[model samples]
Target: MDTDADARVAAGVTALSERSTERAGDEFTRAAWLSLADPRSDEELSPFADEDRGWVGEGLRWLVVAAVSYRVAGREARASRRGVEGIAVARDLQTTRSHPAQRACLDEFVADFRVAAGMDDADAAYRTAADAYREAGDAVDDPHRLATSPLFRAAAAPIEQVARGPANGEIAVEWDDLHGSDPSDPGAFLARRATYKRQRFPSLLDRVVDAGRLAAPRGTTEYGNDSFRCPDCDSTDVNWIAGRTLCLRCSAPMARA
Candidate 1:
């Protein structure tokens, strides 16, 4: 990801962390901390056996291929191979520039880095990631800005449904209760607005879930309700989740049904 985009995601993570800490209560935070402490048990990295192995699986396959190819290749093939691999992962995640600018920003970085690597220019690659990220920032549309830009609706398609519900409002309230954001205050309004903006994208959520930045609930079908899976683990059970179901064991997310 580009610096600016990374910064934005970082900012969102910070917000999510704070909110999680505040609203999820000490129990949730402690559990999350414990999970973080034990990366192996960390729910983030835990295998979702029930998940469908469709585009996401394909993307992962490409990622492995790309990474292996990069590692095995001489310096000449490094940049392009890695770049394509990064894009492959993004595509697998179903991220697109049209909807989630933040995601697009990161993908742009992967693309830029590939070019830099090809040119044998490290600084250029980094700068490209940074510039592209900055440019992408202009396209961002969070909940507060959603009404003004329907583009956000499409980008947020995956997560907006979750974020807009009363549940998220509860989450937001929980955030204020702990962090002390005064909803009635104008200055606090901007902070809240930006905070929600930073936190409200499905693509962003996916990245965090992948990166282990957020705590995902275990038995919730919200994770993989769109796909089918083995009654056991999601693996490539059928190469896709046959039903919009979740893992029965851990409630891990999936996309097959």
Candidate 2:
């Protein structure tokens, strides 16, 4: 039987079917991350787990999706204090997302978010992703720029930073909120919450990392996606921005790349 990429990755399978356990480090990883939040069952996460180390910049995207899932479920789970299912799903997803291939160069993202999901620390994931927003941008201008995956324009728009980067990622939640007076079943709550998120953020992964690039003081020299260009330097280090091909460097409007 043929196993999908996500399942393979989850089981620690090699990237290539015939090759040894080596990193593909090519456009495939780009394709994978860009589609992780595609709302399909193709399993984009599998390929990303073994991509080249440089692609770690994409960690923000994964972190963002995981954070959203965690937050929504965590909230509902708390409201239904007796239900551990929501929390379980959140913890598993967060742990998996938190541990993309080590070569991705995403720093300690996995460590930062593991506890948050395991113990319902939603802020830890979001706050850490916020810091990464700046870091990802700065790396874009470096000699070895932070090469990100394909995504939408607003996906990387600095103005669209989803959650505000609070000084503290931790907050006190009253016990009352846990297993509140809500009358919904735990399973139903999680199902609805997950569905709502999937619909609202169809491309949650793309938005998170791409927004990180935009949120920074700089822009990204991203690859893949549609086409892009810059008017000033004519730099094509761009990606799909809303409806235009925006320049990462000068932020000037230009024709397609």
Candidate 3:
């Protein structure tokens, strides 16, 4: 196995998951504290309090699921030679501009990342995950929906394991599965579910990436031009938006080249 490649993949996933998880936790904590600090009586706040709390709570749950999924995927990437090879392939695709499938994956990944970042409230998070889940169902049934490269399929295998549904004899991971059960100890319940989901399905990140790629733009680049490339990733999918230049592939801010 390529230990170095595995380590790099693990580190990247760990960093992304940890940072996202921390941000969600902070948001939830801040909201909770603010509610407590509010001068309004419980009766006065009751009308809006449940709705607000529900939103934050759902976002926190999804973030927790994301963190667990990342950890599992990272471990899987390090567990076998095939996983290492997959990581290598994925890295290569990220830097190469020759393949249409590569471009599709990059665009999908960027869209997914944007949605993950925008999980500011429960409704948004729930809708995003639900949409992703529905899309996943469709993609699984239609193999030719996206012109998936063999390399992309191989690279995605480890991550895809975490997204499989119970219908496939895998552990249940849909949002409904995670939310429907109400145990006395919510933390313990979530821990159990996370453990089960880790063994079976793809991570939330994987689902989003897969779903977005399934709906990938065909025959054209969204913002990419042959004249510009991201120095960090050697990708030509760079664009200027909102007064700053960004690499859609790697989300790196770069000066125009």
lDDT per prediction?
0.31, 0.30, 0.32
TM-score of 1: 0.24
Query: In order, what is each prediction's RMSD in angstroms?
Result: 18.0, 18.2, 19.5
Better of 2 and 3 by lDDT: 3
lDDT per residue (tens digit) for residues 76-155 in model 3? 22223322322233234345443333333333332232323322232332343334333333223322222133322322
Tens-digit lDDT string for candidate 1 (1-257): 23232232233223332333122222322232232233233233322222221112222222222232222223335435544655544444433234333343334334333432243443343344334434444443332343123222222222322232223211222333211143233223222322333333323333433333232221123323434554435432221121223233322333345
Against the true structure, whose lDDT is highest?
3
* Deviation from native of the Cα of residue 122 in model 1, angstroms: 4.4
Query: Highest TM-score: which candidate?
Result: 3
TM per candidate comes to 0.24, 0.24, 0.26
Clashes of each: 23, 10, 7
lDDT of 3 at 135: 35
Clashing pairs in 3: 55-122, 161-201, 162-201, 162-202, 163-201, 163-202, 164-201
